[model samples]
Target: MKHLKTPESLLFYMMLIREFELKIAEMFAYGKLAGTMFHLSVGQEATSVGTIAALEEGDFISSHHRGHGHMIALGADIKLMMAEMFGKRTGYCKGKGGSMHIADIELGNLGANGIVGAGIPIATGAAYAVRYRGGKQVVLCPFGDGAVNEGVFHESLNFAALHKLPIVYVIENNQYAMSTSVTKSTSITDLYKRACAYGISGEFVDGMDVEAVLETTKKAVERARRGEGPTLIESRTYRYYGHSRSDPAPYRTKEEEEEWKQRDPIKQYQRKLIERGIITENDVKKMGEEIQKILDEAVKFADESPYPEPSEIFEDIYA
Candidate 1:
């Protein structure tokens, strides 16, 4: 997608993401959703909305398990997404992929990976394809802090740096890898420093700030387009919900979650836009109404769509 030129547009995309995830949560609570593996990026809206805004239309992204926000920000159709959530045949992967494996190749979303740290290699391979074919398209790999310790993370970055592959890696460091805190899992909490070992530029950004993520990712995206090597960006962000619906987040204190909510990305950005005269309270209300209508239609479409037949199960897979 082209860079979002205005603040209002950015806010609209972020609002779309915020609503989509909340709707998913609502569906899960009502037992209307298909699976229990859904991961919601509720508090990390700005990181997704901002990072995707920096990419060109030709670029590709390999998404992590928690990637609904990434896809929604990158212009996914809500109707199809909702259909997939309901496990209907009208979905992007014909309901085969569900929430964790959604992909639309035409849209440059390589697919969301369920295995930890797996998408890194997928993005690296895509970048290699671009370099091999002499294509201008770059690839963005967005994963979590948990992926940093995986062997593939090191291997992929080492190769990308060695060959100067047109790729950018952003770690959505939401402070925990499931229940395990980063402080307990890694030797250094400053994850951007890991990029130094690969001889690439690394920077940290406040993921709560949308513009900051955009600017940081934009520089790296541009650098990759210029045939410069990869970059590692640490987006310091959070998740409002537990790792999954099944988790009550006993590991997280209510006090800490409340503190992080104080810097809520969507609320903060909306306030900034209103203060800067880029939007108004009326505009926000209108945006909400419009989004509600669109989402209602999405839910209707999903509910009416049929599930795939058992006979079609062997079709998409290769022998």
Candidate 2:
């Protein structure tokens, strides 16, 4: 099926992303999920939801470490995703991938990478493959602000630009890269300007505004399909939690965090829809209940699912 562009659908997807990540965070807090490295994109749901909404059915996406929202945006099964996080055999990667390594090629998800900036090249390769096959498909590569400093980012962008690859590189600039703020890491502000170095189109977006992201990405996607080139999009967003479960995020002041939360994407969008008469407070309550029920089932499924057997360890290893 094609993208869901309706206001209701868009808002619903954003809500789904929020609830799913929150559930994971809750599970992780309780030590129910596997592994310790869990990154939550709670405040950045709009970026994932809107960017994916701008894509065509045949288009592919390469996601970074904080990629749960990307998969959820593409309408992935929450139960299987939760199972993967639980390291159960029912997961996409048969439980080996854990939270950071789930991949579903059939869904046109090239996969989610644990390494920063690693997915950029994968997306570039997918775009190149699409171009080589003479297909109209495009690729969306989403990474964090920290990934911009990685060497692979520059290399991938240069290659994509040179070949006019059909890819959109989105920097989910949450201002901070781990503990370091973007300002401290980079010399200049407005990361999208880096696109000039590669000679491709660029967009600076409000990651909190889902519709803005959708409209901006639509133009970029259109350009790529016209055989123009890759586009670099810097969607400035935020994270409601620490980098992972370990970091207490002592660096940022309480006031700063509160300021960001004031523009919470889900709440903002819900208000917008409510004001426009597209949805009422009751509608939002019902939607949350629906998503919560799905999440409940996901956790139950993940808990009930079996873990991978020791003997089958190397069965799916291609590399």
User: Model-by-model lDDT, in order?
Assistant: 0.93, 0.90
lDDT of each residue in 1-319, candidate 2, tens digit only: 2646698888899999899988998998888889888888899999999899999887899987888888888889999999999989998889888778777887779989989889988889889999999999999899999999999999999999999998888999998889999989998679999999998988999999999999999899999989999999999999988898788899899999999999999999999999999999999999999999999999999999998899879786775
Worst-scoring 10-residue span by lDDT in model 1: 1-10
Candidate RMSDs in order: 1.0, 1.2
Clash count for candidate 1 is: 0
Error of 1 at 6 (Å): 1.8
What is the TM-score (0 to 1) of candidate 1? 0.98
Model 1: per-residue Cα lDDT over 36-109, one tens digit each: 98899999999999999999897999998899998888888999999999999999889999999988888899
> Which candidate leads in lDDT?
1
Residue 61 of candidate 1: its Cα lDDT?
96
Q: 310 in model 1: Cα distance from truth in Å?
A: 1.7
Give the count of colliding residue pairs in each prediction. Answer: 0, 0
Let me know the TM-score candidate 2 reaches against the reference structure: 0.98
- Largest TM-score belongs to which candidate? 1
